[model samples]
Target: MNTTPPRVLTIAGSDSGGGAGLQADLRTLFACGVHGMTAVTAVTVQNSLGVTGFVEMAPEVVAAQILAVATDIGVGAAKTGMLASAGIIEAVADACDQVGIGRTGTTPFVVDPVAASMHGDQLLTDLALEAVRGLLFPRATLVTPNLDEVRLLTGIDVVDRAGQREAARALHDLGPEWVLVKGGHMWADPECLDLLFDGSEFVELPGPRYDTKHTHGSGDTLASAICSRLARGEGVVEAVRFGKEFVVRSVRASYALGAGVGPVSPLWRLEG
Candidate 1:
C-alpha cells in the first residue's frame, strides 16, 4: 500500500466552538491520514450546543481561495458543507466544476447539505437550499442529508427503511450522482442505518446506534471521512462503510464540553 498522504479540501463554515463545520472536517481528514485544506464560507458564533449567529464571507473571496488552492497545492478530493448563502454556494459550485473537470475520477467530492443545527438553529436559508439543489448537487459525487434535510431537498418524509429507499431514490433524481439518506433521525431501534443510492444500486449501511446528544458534527465528520478515503482511492461503497464506523466511534467517545450538547471527537483514536 502506498503511504503517501492524500490531500482533501473542505468548503464549509467556521465554528468558534471547534466542533462542527470546517473544524470537524479537518479533524476527520487528519484522523483518516489525509492532508486537509479548507475554504471557509461562513463563520458561526456557536457553542457546544448550537449556532447563535453566522457571518458569510464575500463570494469573491471564496472563489479566489478555491482558485488559489486549485492552482497551487491541488486537491485529491473535496467536500462541501454549510454554504450559508446563495452567492457563496454558486461560487463553490463553479469552482468545484473546475475541480471536477481537472480531478475527475481521482478526486471525488462528498457534499453535506447542512441545513440546520441539531438544536434547531437555521444554518441554511431557502435561497441557499435552492443554490445547493441547482448549483451544487449536480456536481457532487455523493450528497449526504439527514431526514429533515431529505424532506427539505425532496419533500420526502423518510420515516422507516422503506421511506429511506424512497427518499434516496427521490434525492438521486435531483442530480447528485449518489444520495445518502441518513437514518440517524429515523424513529427506529437497534441500529443506525444510512441508505446510499448510486443511481444504479442501493447500499444500506447499518451499525450499532450510540445514543448520545453529543453529536454536533456527525454529518460533517462522516462526509469528511468519505472525502478522505476517496482521496486515497477507496470506492464509494467502501468509503461509506468506513465513514459510518468512524462516526460511530467518534460518537461513542463524545465528550460533553459545554452547557449544551457537545460534539463527537472525530480524532478520538489519536487522543493520548
Candidate 2:
C-alpha cells in the first residue's frame, strides 16, 4: 500500500528566529500529518523583538523553487506568505497559475496576505499589494487576511462583524473563490471571531480568545494548517474550521522564547 502522505507547499519567507515563516509552516503541516515543501521567497533577520532586516530572493529563483517542487514531488495544496515585492508577487502568481492552477490536476491555493509582522513591521509594500491583488488574488482558492490586511486591501475599517461583511464583499470582487477575514486582532473582545465568505453565505467561526503575547507565528500556522487540510481534500469551510481550532490551541500553548513576544506553539499537543 502506498503510504505517502498528502503534500502541501509554502511559498514564503524564512524566519531565522524559528518562530515563524517557513519554519512555522513546516511545523504546522507536519502536525496536520502532511508533507511540507517550501519555495523560499525571502530570508528575514528577526527575533522575538521584530524583523531587523530581510533580503528577498530573486523572482527567477523563487519561480524555480516552485517549479522544482510542483513538477517533481507535486503539490496537493499551497499557501503563500510575505511576497515582499511586486516582482516576487508577479513571479509567484504566474508560476502558480501555470504549474499548479493551470495544470490538469487540482492544486488548491491559499493566500495568507501577510502585510506586516506581529510587531508592526511592514512586510508587503503598496506596489506588492496591488500586484498581489491584480496578479495573485484571482488565482487563489482562498484568501486569509487579518483585519488590518482587509482594511489595507479593501479600504474598509473592519471593527465589527458588519464591517467584515462589507470588506469580504469588496475583497471577493478582487477575485478569490473564498475569503476568510480573520478577527484575531479584535483585542477588546473575549470571544474571537473569524468570518468566512464563499461569495454566497457567511460562516462565523468563533473560538476561545486566549490572552497571550506569544502569537508571533499565529498567522503562518493558521494558513499552513488550512493548506494542509485542503491538501487532505477537506472543503474550504472545513479547512477553515480546522485551521481556527489549530491556531487557537497553538495560541493557548504559547510560551515566551526570546525577549519579545513568542510564537504560537505548533507542538502544543506533544509538549503538554
Candidate 3:
C-alpha cells in the first residue's frame, strides 16, 4: 500500500447540486491529489442554478463532526465555508483548538467568509459575522473574501487593485494571519486581480478574466483548492496561483444545469 502525501479537511456546508460547498471542496481536493474529509455544517436544497434553502446543523453537531474528523484520520489543512451562525463558528473554532493542527503545531485554516452563496442568497446573519470576526479569523491561516464579502466584512470598497490591498490589510487586522481580497467584481478590469496581504507585504495575483456567467461557487472552490494545495506543502502564493488556474478552467468549462446562473465545475480539469 502507498501512503497519500497529505490530508485535508473541509468544515463546510453541503451543496446538493454538487457544484460548491463541501462537495466542491472534496472534488477539488481529490483532483489536487490530496485526501479529502468533510464535516458538514449545513445542508442546502440547491442545484447548479442556485440555493433554494439551507438548514444549518446544530452547533453541537457541527462541533462533533469537527472532532470526529480531527481525532482520527487527520488533516494538514482545513477550510471553512458557510458557517450559518455565530454559535456554529464558535464551536468550530473551539474544536480546532482541541485537535491541535498537527506536527507543525498549527493547522492551516482557510476561511472563505461565506456570508452569502454565489447566487446572492443570504447565508450568514449579522450576528454570525460578529462571531466570525472575533472567534474564527484570529485562527485562520488565510481568509479569502470576494469584493462584496470584503466590503461586508471590512466595510471597505475595493473598487481597484490598490483598494483591494487596503481592504486586505484591514481584514488582516481583524485577525486572519493572511487575507486574499478577490477583484472579480471589477468588471471593467482586463483581468482577475487578487490581492493577498500577509501582515507585511501585499502580493497581487493577476489572471486573464474569462467572460462568462457560469461563475457560481468560484470563491469557495478557490479557497478550498488553495487549502488542498497548501496541505501538500505549497506556499501561500503558489497555492493561490494554482487555485486561480483551477477556478478559471472550471469557469471556462462551466455547464448549464438549471434556469439560472450555472456553477463552475471544480472538477473541470479532471472531467475534461
Candidate 4:
C-alpha cells in the first residue's frame, strides 16, 4: 500500500488564539492524517472572548502564496476559509482557477463561507460577500455555510427544514456543486441537523445537539476535515459524512481553554 500522506492547502486568516482560522485548519488536517499547507489572507487579533482587530494581506501576497504552493508541493485538495476582502477573494479564485480546483478542475476544493465568528464578530465585509458567491462558489466541490452566511449569500433566512431546502437551492443556483447548510445555529431543535444538497436530493445528517458553548473552531475544523477526506480521494458525500462524525467527536471532547469558549480538539480520538 502507498504510505505517502495526501497534501491539502488552506487559504484563510490567522487567529492569534490558536482556536480558529489557519491554526485550526492545520490542526484538523494533521488529525485527519493529511499534510497541511497555508496561504494567510489576514491576521486577526482574536481570542476566546472576541476579535479586537484584523489586517488583511495584500492580494498579491495572497496570490503568491497560493501559486508557490500549487507549483511546488502541489495539492490534492484545498479549502478556503476567511477571505477578508473582495480583492482577496478574486485573487484566490483566480489562483485556484489557474491551479485547477474542484469538479471542473484537477483538485477538489471546499469553500467555507466564514463571514462571521461564533461570537458574531464580522470577519468579512458586506461587499466581499458578492465576490465569494460569484468567484469561489462555482469552483467549490462543496460549499459550507451557516444560517447567517446562508442568508448573506442567498438572501434567504433559513429557520426551518423547508427554509433550509429553499436556501440550499438558492446557493446551488449561485454555482457550488454541493451545499451543506450547517445547523449549529439552529436553535429550534434540540437535535442538530445539517442539510446537504446536491441539486437533486437532500441528505439530512442528524446528531445529538450538545449543550456546550466551547465550539470556537468547529466550522474551520469541519471544513478542513472535509477537505482532508477529499484529498484522500473520498467522494463528496462520504467526505461530508466523515467530517460531521469527526466534528461530533471533537466537540464531545472539547475542554475549556480561556475564560470564554475553547476549540474542539481535532485529535480527540487519539486522546482516548
Candidate 5:
C-alpha cells in the first residue's frame, strides 16, 4: 500500500525571519498534512522588525525551479506569493503555463497577490503589480488578495462588505475562476469577514476578530492552507472554507517571538 501525502508547490519569496513568505507557506502545508515544495523567487533580509533589503532571483532561475519540480515530482496544487518584478511575474506565468499549473491546467493555482508587508513596506512595484493583474490573474484558479492588494489591483477601496463584493467583481473580471477578498486588515469591522465570489454568487466567511499583533504570516498561511486542501482533493469552495477556519485557529494561537510582530502558528494542528 502506498502512503504518500499529497504534494503542494509554493512559488514565493523567502523570509529570513521565518514569519512570512515561503517559510510560512511550507509550515502551513506541513501542518495541513501535505508535502510542501517551493520555487524561490526572491530572498529577503527580513525579520520580525521588517524587511530592510531583498534580492530577486533571475527570471530563468525561478522558471528552472518550477520546471525542476513540476515535471518530475509533480505538483498537485500550487500557490504564488510575492513575484517581486515584472520580469519574474512573466517568467512565472510562462513556466506555469508550460508545466500545466493554472486555471487552464491540471493543477489548481492560487495567486496570493502580496503587495506589501504587514509593516506597510511595499513588496511589489507598480509594473510588477500590473503584471500580476494582467498575466497571473487570468491564469489563477483562485486569487486571494487582502484589502490593500484589492485597492492596488482594482482601484476600489474595500471599506465594507459591499465594497468587498465590488472588489471581488473587479478581480473576477480579470479572469480568475474565483476571488477571495481578505478582510483581515479591516480593523473597523467587528468580525473578520472574508468574501469569496465566483462570478455570480458570494460566500461570506466570517471568523472571530482576534485582537493580536502576531499576525505576520496570516496571509501566507491562509493561501497555503487553501492550496494544501486543493491538493488533498477538496473543491475550491470547500478548500477556501477550510483555509478560513485554519487561519482563524492559527491567529488565535499566535504568539510573539521577536521585537516586532510575530507569526500565526500552524502548530495548533498538533493538538489533535
Candidate 6:
C-alpha cells in the first residue's frame, strides 16, 4: 500500500482569520486528500470583515521557501495567491522555473489571481498586478480569476456568458494554457457558471447559486481543489469539474464565523 499522498504547494499569504489565503488552501488540499506545502508570501491582519494590514516576505525569502520544499519533498502541483508586490511576483516566477512547476515544467501551476479580499480590500499593488500578467501568466498552467480580477487584469467587465468568453480569450492571450473565468461575482446570474477555455475549446461548469454571504475563501477553495485533483493525476478539464463540484458542496455546507462573512467549508468532505 502506498502511504504517500500527492503533494501540492501553495505560494500564498496567511489569513490570520484562517478563512482564506494558504489556510484555506491547506484545508481544501487536505480535504481533497493531498499533502499541502507552503511558501508564505505575505502575512495579513484580517478577519471575516476585511484585511486591515499586511507584511510581505522578502523576495529572496519567498524564493528560498519554494526551493526548499520543492527540491527535497517534491511537488505534484502548486498554486499562488495574494503575492503583494512586483518583486515577490518576479521571485515567484523565477523560483517556479527553477523548480519545474509551471507551464513548461513538470508540475502544474494554478494562478488564483487574488487581487482583493471579498470585502473589497486591495491585497496586491498595480505593479504586482502587471508582474502577474507579464511574468506569472505565461508560466501558469491554469489562471483562475474571478470577475473583478478579470476586470483588473484584462479590462473586461464580464457581466454575462458572452463577456466571459471575451475575458477568457483576453486572458488566454496573456499566455496561460488554460483560463478559468469564475462567475461567482456575477450576482444577477441565476446559476453560477464558471467558464474554462484552453485556447481552442471551452467548457462551462454550472452550479447552483447558493444564497449565502459566507463565501470568503470560495476562490481559494476552488483553485486549491483543482490543484489537488491535478496532483492526483487528473487532466485539466476533469480536475476543474471536480473542483467545481467540491466548491459547490462546500458553499452549501458553509456556516457563519466572525462578525461579517464566513468561509466556505471543506468540512463537507468529512461528512458521512
Candidate 6 lDDT tens digits, 160-187: 9999999999999999999999999888
For candidate 4, the per-residue lDDT at 148 reads 84
Candidate 1 C-alpha lDDT tens digits along 1-272? 97658888899999899888899999899898899988989998999756778899999898888878877888888888888889998888777776552224346878899886684345677888888888778777889998888878777777789888988888888788888888888856467988889888888888777767788888999999888888888888888889988998999988887898788987687979
Better of 2 and 4 by lDDT: 4
Encode model 4's per-residue lDDT on 1-272: one tens digit a residue: 98779999999999999998999999999988899999999999988888888899999999999999999999999998889999999999889888887667889999999987675555677789888988889888899999888877777888888898899899998898999998888789787899999999999999878888888889999999999889988999999999999999889877788888888888785575
Pairs in steric clash, model 3: none
Q: What global local distance difference test value does model 5 have?
A: 0.93
Clashing pairs in 6: none
lDDT of each: 0.83, 0.87, 0.81, 0.89, 0.93, 0.93
TM-score, cand. 3: 0.94
Lowest lDDT 10-residue stretch of candidate 4: 116-125
lDDT of 3: 0.81
- How well is each residue in 1-272 modelled by candidate 3, as lDDT tens digits? 89866888888899898777888888878778888888888999987667678888999999898788778777789988888888889888888888875222477888888885564445678888888888888888888888778767887877777787788888989887788888888777888888888999888788878877877778877987898788888788888888888887787877776877677886666764
How do the predictions measure up, each by TM-score? 0.94, 0.96, 0.94, 0.96, 0.98, 0.98
How many backbone clashes are present in model 6?
A: 0
Superposition TM-score, candidate 2 onto the true structure: 0.96
Winner of 1 and 5 under lDDT:
5
Candidate 2: pairs in clash: none
Query: What tens-digit string does per-residue lDDT give for candidate 2 at 40-121?
Result: 9999999988888899999999999999999899999999988889999889877887785522237899998898667444
The TM-score that candidate 5 achieves is 0.98
What total of clashing residue pairs does each candidate reach?
A: 0, 0, 0, 0, 0, 0
Per-residue lDDT of candidate 5, residues 68-108 (tens digit): 99999999999999889999999999999999999778899
